[model samples]
Target: MNRKIELLAPGGDVDAIKAAIIAGANAVYCGLETFNARNRAANLTFDDLLGVISLAHRYQCEVFLTMNVVILENEIPTLVKLLNQLVNTGIDGIIVQDLALFHLVNKHFPSLLIHASTQLTTHNEGQIGFLAKVGATRVNLSREMNLAEIKSLTRYAHDLDVLTEVFVHGALCIAFSGQCYSSSVSVGNSGNRGRCSQACRDEYDITAAGNKFPLNLKDNSAYFDLPELVDAGVDSLKIEGRIKGAQYVHTVVDSWRKQIDKFVESGKLLSDDSNLYKVFNRDFTNSFLKGNLTKDMFIDNPRDNSFKHANDKSNAISVVQIQEAQQTLSSDKDAIVSLVADKVSQLSIEKISLSLHFSGKLNEPLTITAVTKDTTVEIQSAVTLTLATDSRIDEAAIVKRFKSLKQSEFELLPFNFDGLESDLSIPFSQLTQMKNQLLFKLTKREYIGAVTLPALTHYPKLNTQPTLSLLICDEKDVDLCDVTDADIYFKLPESFKVNDNKYIDIFLRNPRLIPWFPAVLIGKDYLESVRLLETVKPKRIVSNNTGVAFIATNMGIEWIAGPFLNTTNSYALLTLQERLNCAGAFISNEINRNQIKNIARPKNFKMLYSIYHPILMMTSRQCFFQQTVGCNKPSIEDGCMLKCEKATTITNVKGISFAVDKQKGGYPSIYNHEQFLNIDAVEDLSHLFDEFFIDLTDIGSGSKAKIDKVELVSHFENVLKGITESKTSLKQLVTISTNAQYQQGL
Candidate 1:
């Protein structure tokens, strides 16, 4: 028997949600006003979400709410309150990015289903195990994954009873999701906090290749890839346009719905995708899904390409033909809008009208009845009513007690008390029991009591004076190990030769150099990394990748969570320490001073922070040189990861320049114009951290002159020693530096 594949749609507003349901969406993912990734979308309110859930469920469509942002320490209380309310709202699942949410939902609110967000960058097999251990029931695979990779990962996930979702349509990010900090460093709008300014879509100075928007990629459309995805065992096909409107949602969902039904009924696919091009797009591409990274994936323009596509497909060379194409597109869009509006008009999400009746007689049991459009619930008090002068149950008392029903998905109408005797008395406890029963019958949800987490005990620092640490990539900087006693972490690239012992020898030769793992490691590279860990057997390592951390834990080797893991709150600390047995973790730099100060560390767990480093904006598997400097090769090959060395700068129209840098064995990456230097954190947050790190790796320099690694280590050490004069000297040494992130945090 073939399993049914779910068609998930985005709902940025109430109308869009209704449109999706009417167009045959199996599930719709929507966000409330706060804590969702698409902050630009017109999100729903709490009351609106209740109605949406009720309405979607009525059509057999599940609703998943997105709380997919990193949580700050102070926001934990509010987040908990929201979770408590969500438990009784009949929400199907919650899509989350923060590890703190995983801990809270697993420990306190086990009833809420947890789905891992794409922001976690889940690509490798070990990451599936890690997410499963953290209590995720479903995981949205990274959009960059190919069909083969998705199949293998999905198989592994299924072994643990976890489902997988893939982005079948919508806009694509140039960089890996959640890993990009371009908006955060440039505008103080952290994507982790749902405030992305979309720096990737900004118009830049024309590159050598003569492209204006070098980083903008064509929108993703997998309309013809349904069979392949189903064979790959993907559970849900997710459309990625939460910031889009109802017209776009209706057109895309309607198209996919027909396609899916056709394929399922007779194993035949719909040949036409014209309805898709009638909506907003930057054209379309399936290169990423096909495992081909080429220059054609990029689009010079970032606006809607519907009219342009129509004109080009018609081969319109004359102005009249172009105008005709535009008019046709306009007409098509309006037709879709009208069609969707009519279909959704037949549906309603209004609050259900509720009526209440009270009836009783002397020496008889008191009875209360509740009526709604769909349900009728009646409950009799165990105790009989008695005639009384004081403390009688009047209309005012009944109104006050049952008015709380407004909190549910019901609007209270006038009470029907004509059947009851006036001023009859019964125990208030009986009334409370009757009200609870009415709520249970009407909502069909058990009342889950709220959970209040106890405060985390603050642990004292093990070292009174935090030591300085340095990260180095090149072998030439190995001499710095002699200059400072601080821990020198050797940087590992994202790719490596299969069964190669090059890195293993490097680690064996230098035992004092702790291995530092990068965030992304896929396929053979991940296996090679595991082989290196098994061979070298280092005492300790710093890992930005959870896949490596999972293997390290299995080997009983102590692992320190790197900065890319995005640890922000106390529950996040508990997750690392308790679940993964992580020895320590680096607090995320994306947060502000106040947010950082409130984090409580687990007992005997080390905390670290980077005080000086180049700020990475974004990283991508696609070749940056192809779009910027015009590569001779048509597409990126495996050799490019181990042999390419390129650097260039692209200035935006706003006069802000970003450096695109690619190392010999790393992915093509973009860096901020200025390096991040937070000297004030040494004095302000020194006591909370055990080590302050400095990135001595000579990456992300772009066109700037390189700084001496020895001088960097010396100055950082002096500052850690409480030398105020060295702070000024260090700032002078690194002329292009900014601490804006420390001041204006997420």
Candidate 2:
């Protein structure tokens, strides 16, 4: 049998947690005061987190802690400390998005179950497989995935032993997960770092010739469906509300509980349940889950007009009838009675007086009077009529009798028609009088199912284990060693100039930089014409970028990058090859582990174990200068400001600013000043370059401006190297840079 799907609920506060547990939820996801996606939600403190976990555990419900926000370099250390505290507190699992944090958790707490948060934009099978490989046990599938897409993903994940969870209810987002720019564009806040201001929910207008077109005002309601998603069959059903109130959570949970139970009992899913609309629903449309939604789905009109109509009372009446009856003492002489009426109104009846005349051998017209409210309505005739004493009758009979009462057209009451059951017994006369009274008091008591105790799973005391893997490499010049059974190659330029030879200086400074050389050679060179290289003799030469390679017939020069320069070629051919090599070489912004992989296919690349800091990104354009208007010194805490001509803005989160360049195809550009000086971990390249080179001419530097900035960069690079060298399992890496220099004069 397939595993039973768990119902995951949201708990913004303690009350919401209680409501979720009481309403048959199997698990609850919550956030703490810091580092959660819902930072604005009144999140739990450290004590509250521990308390919630303990309480949820007692009830046999799993509690998932959300630490799913993007962290800046300076935030990493604090986050690591918080993660350490949480691991000690015995959290069941953690939701994460940041790759560095993921690495940190895997290194420090390998046994901890990691869930890929929805903000990661994990839409396809390839992304899921990648995440699973990196120790993500479960992936919260993107909200935009349709039924067919979900099924396809589930099938693909099953083979890999990864679980797929999908959101089955709650508010829907207009943008794709992790792809939203509304927050930054509208409010200068980064949504990826948990500071969204919900700009999508705001109203907007399109205008032409001074005439405004209200794009979202047709039906006067938001159009997203929550009910249809429940039938999609996810491994876990998630309700999305961390900032919503407890009442909203309770109402939605209760409705879904009843709906799920009804579906299970009847073996059919009902779509037109009007009760669902009462539970805080918008105009329902299956957004993207069915297909690309229509323009109607974008309607953002308020439901104010519908509120007036909602207050309008319906004049329709509900009528129920008694179909059969039998005596408890006599089963053979059973009498079947039916009650009929035209309308039912809102009125209470203390006693239902039934007038019944029995036709029998008594020779006297006998009227049977029965009290329908307190005692069983029995006919008092000499010839007795048997009644059905089925336990299902008492409840049903009251409902049927009350429903058959008629009222004036203006006195209509909203009745729960489905609440009436089919099996009921009532005296023929009492059923007739019940039409006049809307409310009936029955002698029988209402029976609600007893709450069964949940079987609790005993979670063992968590034993924190070290989670980092250690790799060691020795520094050795393999090129200078024996060339036995080795294919040697060198990447060389066709011509050289001493005046303009920075690329040559960098290459000569670190000839054994395994990954950097490969990356520079693989891509098309952006700037190669200015630099020149002299002819070099080698057995085989390869060219990369726009530069050419040269090889002599006898010399053993192995070209590691760019197009191949054969030994059969002459001197002029070698010069042409060098120029061709320049076409494919360009410098990368910042080098990371992933970039290293892209560079060289080494069996085992050595990492620099001891270093001060690391740089995160490199750009041809100056990001901080663009944000600060005219490059004024701004205080570090005040953040950098970039004013754009093409309606673009940048939000600086944790020292990194995400600039949406409207002039540059709206591609997101990440800018950080500290990433340039970090030393990459390598086994045998210490002999050549003593420091990483950073060109800061674009920022128009001075001692006051460049010193502090470079110092911060150097610190991060060294710290990264130190962590690697110490072989200590690191939970996080943080880089700090202040806007103090920019704020100094202000």
Candidate 3:
């Protein structure tokens, strides 16, 4: 028989867990108080987790513990202890974001299944294959993927014996998951670490009338796409909210449960998502799953809005909302829970075959034998039944007594005393006692299965005294970067000429030149360009995608990972080196300076110190300019207006400015308020980085027009020399950024 798709639910607290089980979820995934991505949620304690596991198991459901945070080096000791303690807690699987969890868990407790979190930023088959080879049983594909992408990925992952999971409902991030850094830049708190300030929900001036929420993508509800996803062989469908209250969770889960059941039976989704919208939602966008690359995915005029208020900006929910929702759940909880219990109590799975030996004589004791799938449990009552004068214990009466197992978790298979009289007298109280003993013995055993993990063979080495480099966006900007005393790192934009050799001559002269690939490539065009550029054999290759890592590994070309791959924790950094064949990496810019310090890998491991490029707030396949001006294409050549070349500014109501810079390719990336200039602070961490790079893609000092080649080269040259010489005291230094606290986090 084909296994049905697992109905998974989110459990933020004990109440949510119970509600999910009651709502008919086959499995529940939740986080504990420590080492989870939802650190801000009311996560469970050890005792709470134990209770949750026991409760879910009692109802024939599984519990998966969340350890999806990118762990720091210092946190490893605590994590080790936590995993060891959780070994016997009846946790069926571990949902993780860090590679170290794979290493540590596989080394010690090999029985648990590892799930790769969405934070890992895996989009391609290469990334998914790497995780599966390293021991990921299931990989949660990125929510940004279209249906075609999901189908292709699911097919590939299935070949490798890995299950695939996707998010089907709830809020969607404007930026890609794990690739966003707006929170870190705006609030000095990292979203990857679960302290997001919801910077995307902030209002930005998209029109002259008012500042609208342009960066906020509409919440996704792929209810109608369930059939297609099932056809694609998806193993699980996950709902997005964990911080939401129990009533919201219960309603959502119940709705999805009914919808899925109906679809499975009839091959179509049931109508009515009214309860879904009433509870909470941002209208709905099936764009990602539909592969609909259009601007309508966001809330435009605000008239047809799905949700009126900002329910996402803060996870610290209102007291009234919580109390109100709690009441709704309280009134309905008993009915829902009773329905679940009745359904569970009727399952024949809890039944065990029983063989009995009944003594017909007066003083002989009765022995009952019970057999579970793997074990045998036998019990005998201490009290003996006395023979009666007028009556005998009938087979029908004995079977009735044995079959009355309403309160027990086990059922005894039909059995008869072959040689006994139809009316043999027996003590009724003694018979009841024997039945109780049999129930306890058969239902209380835990799984004693052992899991073996593959041997780990790769280790990373650190590179000390890292050098300084520059990111040149175009050939025109190459001259500006050439005069600098640092190693020139050319950034191949997503919109490079398909068959041009104009930039090859520039890098050919400098063997030390490192070429940085765009974090995102539109379609396969730029990637094809990179394939053509490979004839030049770039000495130091920089990749942000694992597909590039695979090419580099096969060609024996040395490459380093960029943060677009989401290497927030040390384990991710190590995974790049050991598994992805990357030499070293640029730590995620989302992390604070303290996290960077504690994330020291092997000594001398190359860690990039990027002195703030135009920090990409978010990127999209559809350009907003084209959306407003009337165009169907994101590229300029496809009958589009060149809105990016003109003055395009979106300021928040608070008067903060954002520069919209659209690329020639389909990708349109939004830059932060100012050029991330953190010169003064780099001095403190100078020993940590062997190389520091200045980003000259968007601005020169303050404005885009003020880009003077000579001034930039001279200013950085002085800063680079003055760190050691101390005498260069920089005659032409730009003023230190006043908002240093935002850039230099503690």
Give per-residue CA lDDT, model 3, range 476-509, as digits (tens).
6656544655767676655545565555766675
User: How far is 396's C-alpha from truth in model 2 (Å)?
Assistant: 69
* TM-score per candidate, chains pooled: 0.96, 0.44, 0.74
Worst 10 residues of 1 by lDDT: 701-710
| Candidates arranged by TM-score, highest first | 1, 3, 2
Q: How would you encode candidate 1's per-residue C-alpha lDDT over 311-386 as one tens digit per residue?
A: 9878888999988888888888888889888988888888899999889999899888888776788888899999
Task: Report, for all candidates in order, the number of backbone clashes.
Answer: 0, 77, 20
Q: What is the C-alpha lDDT of each candidate?
A: 0.90, 0.41, 0.65
How far out, in Å, is residue 431 in model 1?
A: 4.5
* Clash count in backbone of candidate 2: 77
Sorted by lDDT, highest first, which candidate order results?
Answer: 1, 3, 2
> For residue 406, what is the lDDT in candidate 2?
23
> Which candidate has the highest TM-score of all?
1
**Model 1: residues with Cα > 4 Å off, grouped in runs:** 360-364, 382-403, 414-432
RMSD (Å) of each candidate, 1 decimal: 2.0, 25.4, 11.8
lDDT of 2 by residue, 71-178 (tens): 543454577667655654556788876545555656566656888888765556645665665567888987767677777777767777877788767666654555
Which prediction has more favorable lDDT, 1 or 3? 1
